[model samples]
Target: MTNATRISATLPPDLAAFLDEYQETHHLSSRSAALAEAVRALRDQNLQEAYQELGEAQRSGQETYPDDNLDGLENE
Candidate 1:
């Protein structure tokens, strides 16, 4: 298991209430679990954006690949 860290923050009444309701509805153990999941989701989004940018750069010829292995294949 990965190491865990504890953090504390204050939220507005409405946000606090929403989180409470979400925990009850989803049966989450604690706020930390919910927040951790949220952070993981955000990280995934960032990684996806980075991958998209790399693809765009490659398409625009801003990136290059050397053809070191000249393998022959028949195109049907």
Candidate 2:
């Protein structure tokens, strides 16, 4: 299975033009691949920020996950 699905999106004309140029410039297989790469990049960025927040909370001696409220949770 390719794990692919077709979805429709409404993009502004300017943004749509930009995506087309970006896809051509990067030689992506398709616009879907370009959008997927953009989504992956954003996902990685969000994960990085979340990890940084966890690290900061740990440094400040704050409970990233409160043990008192956690039920059926394993910390292994």
For candidate 2, write residues 26-68 as lDDT tens digits.
Answer: 9998889888888778877876777798789989999785556
Q: Put down candidate 1 lDDT per residue, 1-76, tens digits, no spaces.
A: 1676777879899987887887778888988777666666787787677678767888998854346622222221
lDDT of 1 at 74: 29
Model 1 TM-score (2 dp): 0.68
Q: Which candidate leads the pack in lDDT?
A: 2
Model 1 gets an lDDT of 0.70
Which window of ten consecutive residues has the lowest lDDT sum in model 1? 67-76
Candidate 2 stretches with Cα past 4 Å from truth are 65-76
